[model samples]
Target chain A: MGITSGRGRLRTVSATAAVLALSGTGLVAYGLSKQDTATPPSPGRSTAAAESPSGAASSPPPARKGAAYAVPQGDVLDRSQPTRVRIPSLKVDTDVIDLGLQPNRRMEVPQNGKQAGWFTGSPTPGQLGPSIVAAHVTWQSKRGVFFELGAMKPGQRIEVDRQDGTTAAFQVDQVGQYPKASFPTEKVYGTVDRAELRLITCGGVYDGDSGHHLDNIVVFAHLVPSTAPHAHHTG
Target chain B: MRTTTKLALAAPAACAMIFAGASGAHADDGTYTMKLTDTMGNNSGSHSTATVHVMGDQLKVHITGSGFTPNSPHAQHFHGSFSENKNFTCPTSAADTNGDGQVSTEEGLPMYGDIMISLTTKGDTSPKSGLAVDRMPVADAQGNLSYDRTITLPAGAGAKLKNLHIVQHGLDANGNDKYDLDALGESTFAKSLGVSGIPQEATNPATCGTVSGASVGAEPTGGVDTGDGTTQGVEDVGILGLGALTLAGAGGAWAYRRRLGRQS
Candidate 1:
């Protein structure tokens, strides 16, 4: 009877220890996650310019005498096709495919919704005009690259890796939700003198009958001018 | 919800009409597009997209623009050389011949030539109405303008439509949001139009683009099907895992306390 009692106590202690170990591990994981959320990994180059105090002053001055009201010729990049996109806040990293017009002249969408599609008709990312990058919020039984796109706030960062071996970083200027019926085509696709970007995905209530969302979430952003000498070029 | 659904249903049909009207190709029908950009070196944050659809002699001109002086009439026109052999282009900052810091209308004439067709809201659509500010389209309160009109082209004007420059004139040079002679002095082309005391802001070219084939293309209308609704209403997996962990920890603590009680 005494031996059995001792063994039972030992078993209980062992179980408690095991539980404590698991709880400790959970706390450690929680800590790591908190750290991740607080400080996203700062990628090299672009982040350096963004963090610098003189970043704004370093940009080229507005055109000559009419400087007061003139739109600052912000850094415009040469035309280059974007190959990849990364939204650090959403932890979205995906390959970008070229999307052309369909036979009916509508913009083509990504086939599986896992990858992002850059509209080939618009200017490439970091060009003078608005560059469009679109991805799905969710695929069949899976979350797409831009699933949390609607949750993104202004001032977040979106990085696009271009075919020219350069990464163009963009700072979110606004996040807008519009009904699919009035999608503000001109605002989304309008011409801007500076390098701008538009990240789009489906949002709002999902309709089971139509099998689509009722609204679109668009993230408007502008290229963060690099500190490199080439950033001074203006058209 | 019902109204929203009805709007959704009607939107696609309206979009189809716009796309067809903008790009439909037929015999004697051609669509030309222009991407308007700032004429002066100073980026005015003003831009526009002009689409001209020519069906025989009927010309349908549609223009959408923003970043203009609000609530002010912007005189827009198709400017090109009358000579069939000569083609004109948009002027650059060098066109500011008088060094007034703004590109005046007469200074840009060498590049954009004379006004071929005045885009007016009513009445005449001729060069005679070029400076007729009251006849031009006034931008809305937000400094955005949308102009759509169908005009009967004069004989042989359809052929001259290609390669012409589309110029949107009028700006707030002094940032006062009104056309006045305070900032850049009197207008250079005001005398030519027989209108005196016109400010340079009233006649200065704001935006310019060269009319070309429909190769400019149109943006896709409406929303995209970007989701299949698989993950809707589901919490983030990471958060769910964390919640499960927390619950288990609490459960373990309670069990641990009960065991201590029994041991005591």
Candidate 2:
């Protein structure tokens, strides 16, 4: 309860501010397909801050650490498809390929199934924006890149050691299940003006015929400024 | 003023109110949205600040600056409990309860609020924070549910968005949508979204921001953070509707009290 305000007097208080604690203004994310879970688009209005289940009015995060990273304010880079991703938390380190729109903007599962494919729709990791990294939990072949992503807990450490020297470290903060149609892509992959990441894998109950997992496993983390982040990643 | 300033300087513990409001805006869920500011005091020169947006049911997010790596992705969320509330604002002081000089969040001693949000890169940094379905928030804590107390920066050009300073908004972004950020509350967007009146609770509350006993958020139910100008660091912002909730609870409490009287 780091709350400092309520019915209307400014009491001025403070609580733990995690993002500012990390000292970076950007994050990473990838895209996955799902139906919208928000109260329909409502025509002219975009989404409001997530309302309290109780319907209280509030806004988003505002804690800032007086730290600055030299992020290049320039052109959008063309992202190459990520062939694979490695999540040490789940004992997964595998290759990934690209998924295209012909297949309706999804990743192609590896034939032998050693790995899952990356959606071309989102940004590639270390590439400047949010990137979608997904893997199959199980296949006729095997477990995929993000296979164990769902099992992670808070305070658990994760490192995406990119092929390049720049490796991003993320501390797990949240995990949950969502129906295929309930995925908030714009909320998740639309645009945030920062670098971010998203790891996806099929989970929940598996529907054999539909081939869709009852839910999707999403792991969220931020790129810690590697004292020596990859040369290409930093400006 | 300098002595009070000296007393309030650097001692984050003394300014727990400030931090809670900060974390509440950036982390807390439901009725909580904290914001942070730099250089405490009314004398204003701007720095950086941010406003958290816990969109959908997932994360607390804030995407400022130029476009996110242009056609790229970024991982983001409030790195703690992320819930939404119907209304709220920031609190700026501590209410002495139980005669204790210190303010806290414990049940009997101190009860404050907080907000928070964080970001990470992928494959070396990102966590799914936007526009993706297969990938949603991984943990409850990782969800972004808070905001940075908005501030203004001196060098406000290169990355105006990154500076977490809360602006004395003239144009209503009305919940963070730049598309309608300047549509003036006269359009269909304003009428449809219902952004007409300033949040009533924000303007008036049933409680006086103080409590005789250990109240919620330092003051009693329905307090606010003057941290917007008086303090620095983080601040809690929860429209607990507690003041409202308490109203609903009064009938229940009285009935229970009467029942106890008869039982005795």
Highest DockQ: give the candidate number. 1
Q: Which tens-of-lDDT digit does each residue in B125-234 have in candidate 1?
A: 98888988999999888999899999998876765675578889988878888888997778768876677898878888888886432421346756665655555343
Worst 10 contiguous positions by lDDT, candidate 2 chain B: B206-215
Show how many residue pairs clash in every candidate, following the order shown: 0, 201
Those runs of model 2 whose alpha carbons end farther than 4 Å from true positions after fitting are A1-84, A106-109, A161-165, A227-235, B1-264
Residue range A90-114, candidate 1, lDDT tens digits: 8889999877665566666677757
Q: TM-score for each prediction?
A: 0.44, 0.32
Fnat, model by model in order, equals: 0.23, 0.00
The TM-score measured for candidate 2 stands at 0.32
Compose the digit string of candidate 2's lDDT tens values, residues A1-235: 3355463433333223344333321211000011121111111111111111334425332211111212222222223445445555566666666443221223333333365454444445544445555544443323334445566655455555444444555555555444444554544454434445666554432322233333455666544454533313535
Q: Candidate 2 residues B96-115, lDDT tens each?
A: 12212111122111122221
lDDT of 1 at B44: 55
Give chain A TM for each model in order.
0.66, 0.54
Native contacts retained by candidate 2: 0.00
DockQ of each: 0.10, 0.01
